[model samples]
Target chain A: MKLSILKNELNEAIQNVSRAISSRTTIPILTGIKVDVTFQGVTLTASDTDISIQSFIPIEDDRQTIVQVERPGSVVLPAKFFVEIIKKLPSQHIEIEMQDQFQTLLRAGSAEIQMVGLDPEEYPVLPSIEEEQVFSVNGDLLKTMIKQTVFAISTNETTPILTGVLWNLQDGELKFVATDRHRLASRAAHIEVDTELRFHNIVISGKTMNELSKIIPDQNTMVDIVVADNQVLFKIDHVLFYSRILDGTYPDTSRIIPNQYKTELVLDTKKLTEAIDRAYLLSREEKTNIVRLQTKEDGTIEISSSSTELGRVTEQLEVKQFNGEALRIAFNSKYMLDVLKVIECEHIFLGFTGAMSPIIFKSTENVNSLHLILPYRTTT
Target chain B: MKLSILKNELNEAIQNVSRAISSRTTIPILTGIKVDVTFQGVTLTASDTDISIQSFIPIEDDRQTIVQVERPGSVVLPAKFFVEIIKKLPSQHIEIEMQDQFQTLLRAGSAEIQMVGLDPEEYPVLPSIEEEQVFSVNGDLLKTMIKQTVFAISTNETTPILTGVLWNLQDGELKFVATDRHRLASRAAHIEVDTELRFHNIVISGKTMNELSKIIPDQNTMVDIVVADNQVLFKIDHVLFYSRILDGTYPDTSRIIPNQYKTELVLDTKKLTEAIDRAYLLSREEKTNIVRLQTKEDGTIEISSSSTELGRVTEQLEVKQFNGEALRIAFNSKYMLDVLKVIECEHIFLGFTGAMSPIIFKSTENVNSLHLILPYRTTT
Candidate 1:
């Protein structure tokens, strides 16, 4: 294979595909990025047996002309070294040519690097999926949904199914849910899709979802998600992402959410978030990272935490409204802080069923995002 | 102690002193910052046995009152927690008052933090210097000298004295030297001092020198360096820094540097440095990180490296002048790279004695900075 490409274009494509390459892969060829040249353009592919990423650079761009293909062939070169050399090359254009007996030459400016390449046939092939069950959604919305719920998924490998996020679609609405049995996060959004088409359940590994979130641009561009029996493909502008689906049933989380509450309070989200953050700094030295919340009859909420080894911190904030009876409860400050950060709202309402029950946190402006945290039992 | 100080001022002072406080100290009181309040100002001090830092916030600055002293007393509070709370306080001015025994109250806006304090008597007292052998130097010059030599100091504690940078003064010139027995770096600058006052030898730990470099201001500001029998003090404007001197003799590095060479080459510093850096990246995969350099009779230098596991890289650079006979040498690329980065000149002259001897890198514009790197013996 002999080709010359713009340095900037090649750098961007290499970085996108490098996210899927793992240095510790058991498959030797998996540690390299496969490069293929054709009349259409050049394509780069990388995979780690779980997720595959492929990016294409056209022959011509507005800024410069890239990828002049002299001959068409395929070769796999080391990913880490190739990326570093391309990034540090001091020229606008770079030339990569593969000679006989798997010798790859990369030249840019005064620097030239010769590396050994592996046969492209040794690399694993990416799974293919049909476009029949495909749906389109804005990249920004999908990124937001993943960021909000992916962090709540269980990281432990003992419960393999719980390490994935559950994606459900019906009618014109899509929903995402993640839980670790201690805390849960759920988000829903409306997207344009075929009215007759429906997906009852699809669970994707949290690790794969997190990687997709980074590779997909967080803009208004639309991305087509194609779902098959065992493979999932996400097609963006010039990039294609594929991940394997987890083969297990996700537990039903609908019954775990509290339907009613005896106590409720509404307050500005930013103020409460800052107050909780300050309290967390003080409570980090104590076990459970406990912080207490008390609602008074005079429409004020006081947050306090004290550690015998460190110090004590108490903050007071005014509540907009309160319903039912005034009460005091304690819970993990970190969990509450994470929930508040993802709500993205001006006003938040918190509902409590009792002193020793799970509490619900929801935004007044948007009803799609919800967070639930279990309260800690305090002796006092 | 009782006082009300501006939150910004308090935060800055706490941050400065906290750098000297280490959580792993054997002495419990060393983990706390000593806060002393007087009618004129409030002072905060923290020590980690090796170094001590003190910062003062006066009652008035430019006729503006910043600190209000309610009572004259001293107490020690946990350094880490107090700094965190002061940084996050939601008010312009913070009120701090000691109440009862071992309890300190901190108030700012609607946030209140009560922390446990230790008795001030338990804290280690800073050593007092006579200030008889004191000399002043420009803060910028001192900072520059520290940065150039401190990075070469030995990090291993096998030879305790090698971990310190040697500071020597003679004939109105101050010189700094650091070496790990493998490579050495020396820097010097002219300074005005009393004719009768002299400091022949002093060794300060590399870690302490690094800490002082961060707080010293740039420009023509003067800093007084006072040498006591067992401790050294730096009085920079209002802040005071004290460090315990190392208790051993530093090796004489003058004999290791070659005064004459069999071959010499003059080249642009920037081009030479970049070529060496690129060679270093390729040599990193080898066992010794060795790169070979050859000066030819045609006024050209070649840099190359090859690893058994990795491939090979060769780069050619033009030399402005070459004297003596053609020569070839090998050395650790990392050591040479570190020394090259500290050079402050556009052009550098390299002098080599032989294949197994040390190579000296000196700047053509400045005679104060010198780097000596020992060559590695190559089998091929």
Candidate 2:
């Protein structure tokens, strides 16, 4: 490939594609980034069997010349070295030309780098995804939904299905759910989609979802998602991200969430987070991460944690509003902290069915998001 | 200790002393920070055997009331947990009280923490230095001198003396030098001190120097340094930093620097750094970090590095002035980058004796700082 491209645009594209490259891949060529140059634009692709990312740089973007082509060609260069060189290149524009025997020459300012490139044919071909069952969601909203639920996914590989976040769609409402058996997080959003389109058992690995979240544009642009039987493709602007769907069945977490609560309290999100965070420090020493919460009739809640070696942390937080019966519950403060951080609201509604039942946390302002954690049984 | 101290002041003091607390220490009491409250103010101290740091907060500083003493007492609190708790405390003013049996109660806003404290008597006492040899240097200058030379210290503990930076003071000139037998960095500053007071064999561990650098105030305030028999004490503002001197004779590095040069070139420090940095990226892949530099007769230089598996990178840089025999030299680009980064000057002078001899780098604007890296003997 012979072309002169804007250094900034190419650098950004390489970084996005590099997120998919893994050094642990047994296939040597998979460790490299495949570059394709054409009259239309330049495309960079990287994959590690599980996930593949492709980023394209158009010849012209918004009246600015991003790439100028002299010849069209294809080659795969080592991703590790190529990524580092491109980021440290010294010029505003860089010229890349394919030499004899798969050798590539890159010239930026006064620096010239000749990198050994592998034949593009040796690289695995990305599966051509058909947009038969495609749906679109706002990039920002999709990112929020992933953040709110992905962390709850189980990291244990023995139960492979639990390592992914379940995506369920019904009646134009798309919902995401993830649980590690101990805690569960669920978020749903109403989107403009075909009422007949429905899928309930689709699960994407939590790790892949995090990588996809990194590339998603911060802007509120719409992203098209194509779901296949075994693979899912996300078309985000000029980038195409493909992730393999995990096999096996995801357990139904809907029944785990408490439908009714005997005690509920509304508290300032920041104040409660601070109180729990302090209590978390002491509980972490004991390694149990157990923190006790008790509601008072005087419209206040007590949060405390103790360690045999470190002593105790106690805080009385005034609730904005309280209803139902007074109760005391013990839970993993780390899990509670994680749920509170993602609430993104001024106040949060904490509901308790009983000390042994699951405690549900929901944003006071947004009804679409919900999080639940199982209480720890302790003899007090 | 019963007192109400400004949270910000106490937090800063805790953070400074916490640097000296190492969890790897075998002594259990050393892992805790000792707090002594008097009518004057509060003092926080932590030590890991090698280094001890003490910070004192007065009853009032300037016009602000930093501390109000309720009672005089002493206690040792777990450094790891106490440091984290104080940082997240909710109030501007935190009240600390000593309860029965060495239990400490900390109240800040609505949060209350009762921590199990250790007996202050069990904590090791800091050595009282007689200050037979004393000198003062600006905190900013001392920090700069440490940063410029400390990176060259040998990290291998086999030769424990080389792991420390050699501090030599003579004739009102304070000099610091560190070398790993491959590269040597030396910095000297003329300070207003008694000319008769001289200590040439003192060496302090590079790790302790780094810890001391962290507590040095950014402002250009004078810091008094006392050199005792086996201890060095630095009074930085209200913080007293004590570092144990390494027991060994420091190797003389003056003979390693090239006094005469066969080739000398001057160039912009930043440009040379950028060129070397790019070449270092490729050399790093080879694991040898070898980069070649050749001076041209036309006042220019070429910097390049190659990997057998990854290919080559070459860059030609124009020199401001070149007046020496045309010669080619190979050296570790990583070492060259380190020296260039600390030059802190617009222009740098590169002095070379031959292709295999030591290469000296000095700031053209600063005469007191010098760096030398032994060149790699490569056949090509």
Candidate 3:
């Protein structure tokens, strides 16, 4: 195979596929990037069994000539050195030619390199995802959904299914939910889809979702997501991202969210976030990350935390509005911070059922997203 | 200690001294920062035995009232948590008061914190320097000299002295040299000082030099260097940086640099740097880091490297001048790259005595800096 590709185009493609290449992979061939030169364009693929990413550099682009293909062939080159070499090469134009026995030669400017290539056949094929249930979403909205819910996914691998975000579609509304048993984050969007289409319990690992978010251009581009049986494919322009779905049913959590709240507090998101962070400083010292919130008789909210080795922190913040019964409750500050950061609103609504029940936060500016955190029992 | 300090001023002071705090230090108190509030102002100090840094916050400044000292006392607070807490506090003005048993109360806005503080008596005392021998140098020049030589210091701890940069003063000139046996870097600067004062050898650990480089404001501030028997103190305004000198003497490296060269090759520093970097890509794959440089018949320099598992890379770089007999030499590309990165020159003079002799590089822009790299021996 022989091809002449622009350095910028090739480098961008390598970076996209490299997300799936890991040195920790058990399979030796999985450590290399598969390069294929065809009549249409050049394709680079990398995989770690958990996910596979393939990026194509077309022969001609509207902005510039990205690639020039002369022959057709395929080879897998060690990704560890290939990426570094390409980045440091001196020339704008690079020529790569495969010789006898899969030996690859890379020439850029006055420098020429011949890298030993492994058989591309040894690499696993792309997951056969039949675009049966495909839907497109705007890159910006999709990215926001990932950021709003992915952090709530369980990092503990004991419950493998909970480590993934559940995707649900009904009545033309697309929703994403993730929970680590301690906290839950949910985001919804009104997307155009087939009137008869309905998907439930389509769980995708948080790791894969994060990788997809990175590759998806943060512009107004449309990202097409295809689901077939146990595999999901996300196509962002010339890039294709595929991942396996978690094999388990999502637990019913609808009953956990209360329709009515015993107490509601409305406050500036930035002010509340800062108060919690200050209280977190002391709670973090205790290693439990526990902080208490109390509603004062003046309608102000009190946040405090204490540690035996350290000391204690107490903060009082005035809320815009406070009604119903005054309550005191303890919760993990980490969950609160994570929820606050994703909120893009000046004010937020905090609804509480009781001391032992879940506390929910809803952004006043963005009504489509909400976060719920479970309160921790306090011995005192 | 009782003080009302501007939040920004306190945060900046803590950051400056926190560089000396090490989580891996064996001494527990060394991991904390000692805060002393006197009638004048507040001082923060952190130490790791090898190095200690202290930064002072003045009572008043042109911009604002930086510190207001009410009572005088001292306490050592854990640097790790203190730095984070100070950065996240909500108020522009912060008041800190030391209560019973060294329990410190920090108030910012509506938030108040009580952090456990270690006894100041447990912290190590700062080294007392008489400033018997003192010289001041421009902060910019000092930082540049360090960058040009510190990377050559040996990382291996077996030869403790080689891990330090040797500072020698003579004939109104200050010189710095560092060598890891395989490579050596030398830099010299002429400065106005005591006409009759000179020091033969003073070795300061490279680690301390790096930390000092960071603390010295990037502007044109004058830094006073005070040398005692075993300790060196750098004073930048009210901030005092103290570091202990390494034991033993630095070897004389003057005799090894040859005056006459068998081959002299002058090349564009930027072009040669890029070419060598490309060759380095392949050499890194072989782990030997051996790259070949030979004078071609056309008067251009040919650079190449090959590996059994990988392949090979070859490049021809145009030389501005190549005289003497045609020569071939092999050297570690990593050392050359390190020197290239620090050189602020458009062209470089490469002097070669022989294939096995040490190669020397001198920047055409600056004559004060010189780098020497020992060549590698190959069977071929």
Candidate 4:
């Protein structure tokens, strides 16, 4: 490859592709990043077998020249050194040329670096999927959906399928669900899609979703996702991300959600979050993480936690609205805090069927999202 | 204790003293912070048997009420819980009261917390040093001096004295020196003090100096230093720090620094730093960290490093002035980079005696500071 590229533009493209390069890969060539230069643009690709990422830089962006090509060629350079050297280059313009036997020369201002590059043919090819089943979603909404549901996925390796989030599409509604049996988070959005084009039981690992979220633009852009029989591809502007789908079927969770609530209370989200956080500090010391909540006749709730070594924490929070019977329930304070953190609304509505049933949490303003946590049955 | 204190003021004091509390201490009571409240003010103290830090908050400062005291008492609470709770408290005004049996009650807004407190009598008392030998320096100058020399201290525990920075005070000139046998850094400043006061062989651990540097204000405020026989105390605005001096005689480092130079070159500090940093990336991979420098007959210098597996990095840099004979020298690039990072001047002057002797680095604008790095003897 013989080309002169803008330092800032090339550096950003390298960083995006480097997210898929894993240091512990068993294959030697997998540790290097593949670079291909043509008349149209320059492309950088990296893979760790499980996931692959590719970023392309066009010749011009908004009338500003980003690259000037002298020749078209391909080579693979060590990601560890290439990434660091590109970031610390001293000048705004960099020239890269390939020499005899795949020797690569890079010049940035007065500094010149030479490295032995691997043959591009030695690198593994990324899986290509037919783009028949594809759907587009707004980038901001996609990131929010991933953030709201990905944290509840199971981390255990015994049940491999539980480590991924389940994706279901019906009519024009797309829904995501993740659960580790103790707690579950579900988020849904209405996307423009054909009514006949629907898919279910498609699961993607939580880790892959996190990496995709990072590359997605924060503004209101469109992201296209193509689903294949075994692999899925996500296209975000100039970047392409591919991941393998889990093999086993996801567990059915629709029956576990209670259809009715015996008691429902609406309270300010910030007040409840702070009260549980303080109680969590003490309950965490006891390793039980259990906090008690009791409703009184005066339309107030008491939140408290105690440890044998440390003393106790108690707070009385007023509820905006209360209905049904008064009840006392104990639940994990850490789990409750996690659910409350993702709630962006000012008020939250909590529904309880009984002491042993799952407690439902929903943002007062948004009806498309809900969280469920199982209550702890304490003898006290 | 019964008082209402401003949350921000108390939180700052707690954070300052919490730096002295060590989690690995053998003594159980040392893990807790001792709090003493009196009509005059409130003092927070924490110690790890090696160093003690105390911060005092007066009843009122500059006509603003910081603490309103109704009773006088003292208690010891676990530093881990107390520090975190105070930061996350929901209100600006916090009321603390001492209940029966050493139990403490803290109320902020609607949340109430009760913590089991240890007996204040069980806590070890801080060492009382006589303030006979005293001097003062600007806090900003002291912080700068510490940063310039502390990184060269030997981390190995076999030679206990080398782990501390040597302090020499004579004729109102205060000097600090640190060396690990391979590299040395020295910084000196003139303070207004008794000309007859001379002290030597005083060494304080690098770790303690780092912690003290963090607490020192970045602004130009006078800080008093009292040097006792075996302990040193630093008094900042409202904080007092006590540290035990290291035992042993420091080695003499004067003989290693050459008084004469055969070659001297001046170059821009930023350009040299960037050149050495790029070469360091390759040399670090070879595990030798060796970079070669040679003065050219054409009035320029070449800096390069090569690895057996990876290739090489070479850069030709221009010097502002070149004096004496042409020379080639090799040294650890990591050490050279470390010295260059601390230089605040725009231009740096390098003095070399020979290819194998010590190379000196000094800021062209400052006369009170200098750094020395022993060159590596390589056959090439």
Candidate 5:
């Protein structure tokens, strides 16, 4: 294989795929990035047995030549060293040529690096699925859905099914739900999709979903999602993201969501988040990391926390509206902070059935996102 | 103690002294900062047995009132929590007051924090030294001396004396020397001092010197340094720093520095440093981290390094002049990099005694700083 490419273009493409290169050397071949050169352009692939990433640089971009291919071939070079040398090369253009015995030469300016490359046949092939059962959605909406629910998924391996986010689609609406038994987060959005496109059971591991969220751009551009029997693919622009679906069925979480509440309060989201954050800082030294909230009849909410060894902190916040009766409850401050971070609204409505029941938090402006947290029992 | 101080001023003073607060809880009082309020001003002090820092906020600055003191007393509060609370308090001026007992109230806006305070008498007292043996020098020059030689101090605890920098004064010249037996760095400067202020020996611990270096400003303003039998004190414009001296005899490193050499080379410092840095990055994968340099008869230098596992890198640099015979030598790239960083000159002169002896690095512009590194024996 012999090629000369612009240094900036190759650096960008290599960086995109380098994120998937395995730092662990358990699988020796997994540490190499597969490079393929053709008449059209050059493609770089890297995978760590879980998620695979590939980036392609076409020969022409905006009427400018990027790559000149002398011959078409494939080879796998060490990803870490190759990327470092390319980044530090002191030239605008780089020349890369591979010999018959897998000896690769990289030259730029006055520096030359000769490294042994591995045969491309030793690299693992990425699984390919036919484009079937596909749906189109806005990239920004999909990114928001992933961000809102992915953090709530259980990380414990014992309950493997709970580690995947549940995806349900029906009537041009897409919904995502994730839970760790103690707290839950759910989000829904409307997308343009054919009425016949429906999925009864499809769940992607939360780990893979989170990784996809980072690479996908948060814009209004449309992306196509294709589902196979055991795999799912997201195609946006020139990038393709593939993930394996969980084999077990997700648990039914609809019944656990509270339908009614006796006490309700409406407050500004930013003010309440800051107050809870301050209370959290004071409660970090305590055993349960709990903070108490009490609503008075005069439309005032008091946030307080105390530790036996670290003193106490109390803050007062004004509530917009309160209904039903005065209530006092205690819950983990970290869980509440996490839920507040995902609720994208100026004002939020919180519903409580009783002291021990799970509380629901939803935006007063948008009803698409919902968060629930279980209260901790306090002796006082 | 009862007073109201501007939040910004209080925050800055706390941050400066908090760097010396002990994170270990064995001596609980050492983890807190002592706040002393008097009719004159407020002083914050923190110490960790080895180093002590004190920052004073006067009642006025630039004809503006800052702190208003109502009662004269002192108390110690937890350093971590006090700093955090002051940083996050939502007000321009914070009110801090102590009651009959050891309970302190800190209030700003609608937020109030009540923390338990310890009696200031229980805190460790900082050593007091007279200003009879004091000399004034430019802050910038002192900071430069610490930065150049401190990095060469030995980090191992086997020999306690090598872990400190040796300071010697003679004939109105102050010199600093530090060595770990492998490499050595020395810097000298002329300063104004009383003739009777001569010191035979003064060795400050590396850890304490580093702390002082960070807090001292690099400028042309003068700073007062007071020397005691076992402690040294530095009084800047508004900050006072005290450190305990290391108790050991420093080795004489004057005999180790070579005065003459068999070969000498003069080259641009920036170009040579860059070439050596690139070679070091490529040679890091090898066990010895060794980079080789050969001086050709035509006054050109070739720098190269190779790893059996990663490959090789080579670069050429043009030299201005070369004396005596041609030579080749290998040395630790890290040590060379450190010495190169401290050479403050556009062109540097390198003197080599032999293949196995130490190489001397000196500046052609400034003759006050010198660096020496021992060469590594290589098979090829």
Candidate 6:
């Protein structure tokens, strides 16, 4: 396509769209970025069959011009090389023109680069996400919700559906849940929505969610989510991120979470996280990843891990509050650390029904999210 | 051994010596660090057979108490885990006690870590350099010298000597030279030295030079370099870094560095570097890494590279001065970019003997360091 654009603006847009370009794509044209020039703006799109990303730079804004249209046309340039060239181009203003045989000439300052571009018709089209089931949420809040739950998704391809985070919407609350069987994480946020704009059983791959979170701004901007039959689209400002949903139904996890607790403890989040991390180092050597926690009569908890070759580590911390029968439990130290990391509160509440039951952790100051990790039953 | 030291101080000492611990070493004891505590201070040492690094923290330094020596003993602990644990310790004051049977207890705040330690008797001893061939040089200058010349060392192990940087000390001048046969870099500095301290060919591996460069302080403190038969020791304050010297005669590189030039061009180092770098992107794709530079009838030169499939890039940069004969030369743009990155001067002088001869680059402000890159032969 023929267009004159600011190198900085185009570079940033190219970087955003490049997140969808996979290095191991089987299709030839899929390795390229589809560039289209129109009277309004220039759009750059990249897709890997599973996901698609498009970033548009408008011709003019309030302050200055980002791109100027020369002739409206379309072409697909190699994403791998085009991204590198745009970043290292020597000047502020860049001139891109399409010539005969789809030869694209890129000129900036005193340098001129010519590359053979592929026909735009060969590139895959972005899926049309035209479902009326759409909702708007804060960009930062969406990022946080995805971060808190996406890491818990199972990466095993045998259970394809479990590799995705389940999305459920009811009333005005939107929730995300991910479980790898042993551990589960859930986060919820409130967003304004129409009565008919409710979606359930929608599962998006954890990888796609991670990419979307990266592009979402941390500022208080709004992001619109639209769900189609098999594809979902996340719109953030001038960028569109689209991903295919998993096919199978997600398992019902509500019954696994207990409403009552036999033992409860409230402790500083950072302190407990550090103690678990230190214990994890030893457990990681043992290959069991198991750490023992025992409550004493003196209102202190002892955390210990041992390896046959590396000895043991025992840590004692007087938590803020510990009640119920003196409890002794062994759990995966890595899962506990992961739960503690997503929590931003100073204090966290942990509850256990018994040694073999699922342990739950929730931020002491917030009730919208909770994590459950099943304890490891040791022979001792 | 029993002692209480600040976490920060112990962490720094562990980090400095851990560099010598190799991940792929075959010796079991070599993977651990030897910690020796005496009335004087605590010494941390790590060795990978070829290189040994020891960092000592005195019992008390000036205003701060660095180490409290409760008992004198030594034990070898796993360097990999100790470094990470010291960095993540929970308290400022760390108490380490070695009990019977070499059981090491590390306590910080409310956390206690116990680890099995290997007997220090099995650890390799550091080589003692007895040669009076010792010379002192500025630590900052030594770091720069290593940085400028080490990049050109041959990474190919076939040529054992070329993989090391040749150190030449003569007539109060210290020179570091490295070449991979395709290119050569030489850096020299004047240092006060005894007449008997002249050494012709003492070559140290580029990998060891890189580690030494990282440990050298940025300040202008003196670094005592002691040279022995097959070992070299660099002493900076209380840290001792020792490396085994290569056992081969270095090839003579003087004949390759041309003493005469047919074409001389002076240009802004940064501008030419950027232009050549842009041309490099295309040349890299071609795999030949060939970029052509032709002096115009005017004072400007053209830099261009083309690939059969990916097209070409052409850049023109004006030179401050162009004299001697008109010339068109092709060279590896990546080599030229490497030379440009190491030069500190704004403007650089480039001299070419012929179309296929070596091209020399030197900072216009300094003549003590220079780079030579052999040109590629092109049909055109």
Top candidate, metric DockQ:
2
Q: What are the chain A TM-scores of the candidates, in order?
A: 0.97, 0.98, 0.98, 0.98, 0.95, 0.98
lDDT agreement with native, every candidate: 0.87, 0.94, 0.91, 0.93, 0.85, 0.91
Considering the two chains of model 4, state its CAPRI-style docking category.
Answer: medium
User: Whole-model lDDT for model 4 versus the true structure?
Assistant: 0.93
Residue-pair clashes per prediction, in order, are 0, 0, 0, 0, 0, 0
lDDT per residue as tens, model 5, A1-380: 89999999899888877777768768887788889999999998888776787888899899789999999889998888888878877788888899866778878776777776889999988888988788988878888899899989999999988898988888878899899999999998877888777785577889888777777766677878988888888776656677788889888888878888899999989888888877787788675779999986678999888776557788888988888878999999999999899889999999999899898999898798889989998779
**Residue-wise lDDT of candidate 2 within B9-64, one digit each (tens)?**
99999999999999799898998999999999899999998999999999998889
Candidate 1 stretches greater than 4 Å from native: none
Q: Lowest-scoring 10 consecutive residues by lDDT in candidate 3 chain A?
A: A123-132
Ranking by DockQ: 2, 4, 6, 3, 1, 5
Q: Using TM-score as the measure, name the better of candidate 3 and candidate 5.
A: 3
DockQ of each: 0.69, 0.89, 0.74, 0.78, 0.58, 0.78
Query: Which regions in candidate 3 have their CA more than 4 angstroms from the true location?
Result: none
Q: Candidate 6 at A173: error in angstroms?
A: 1.0
lDDT of 3 by residue, A1-380 (tens): 99899998899999999999877998989989999999889999999988899999998987888788888899999897888889888889999999988899999888888899999988887878776788988999999999999999999988999999999988889999999999999999999898677889999999999999999886799999998899889999999998898999988878888889999999999999999988887788788899999998877999999988777889999999887998999999989999999988999999999999999999988889989999999877
Write down the TM-score of every candidate.
0.97, 0.99, 0.96, 0.98, 0.94, 0.98
DockQ pick, better of 3 and 4: 4
Q: Which residue pairs clash in candidate 5?
A: none
Candidate 5 lDDT tens digits, B1-380: 78999999899889889878877758889888999999889999999888899999999899778999998789998788888878888788888999756778888876778887888999988998977778887888888888889989999899988899988877788888999998999999888976555775588888877888778776766788998889889998778989888888899888989889898999889888877877787777675779998987667888888876566777778987788778899999989989888787899999999889898999898889888999999879
Off by over 4 Å in 5: A217-223, B217-221, B342-345
Q: On residues B255-365, what C-alpha lDDT tens digit does candidate 3 reach at each position?
A: 999999999988998898888887788888788889999999988989888889778889999999887989999999999999999988888999999999999999887
**For residues A1-380, what per-residue lDDT tens digits would candidate 4 score against the true structure?**
79999999999999999999998998989889999999999999999887899999999999799999999999999898999999999999999999988889999999999987899999999998999899999999999999999998999999999899999999989999999999999999999988787899999999889989998987888999999998989999899999989999999999999989999999999999999999999999899999999998889999999987778999999999999989999999999998999877899999999999999999999999989999998889
Looking at model 3 chain B, report the run of 10 residues with the lowest lDDT sum: B192-201
Fill in the DockQ of model 1.
0.69
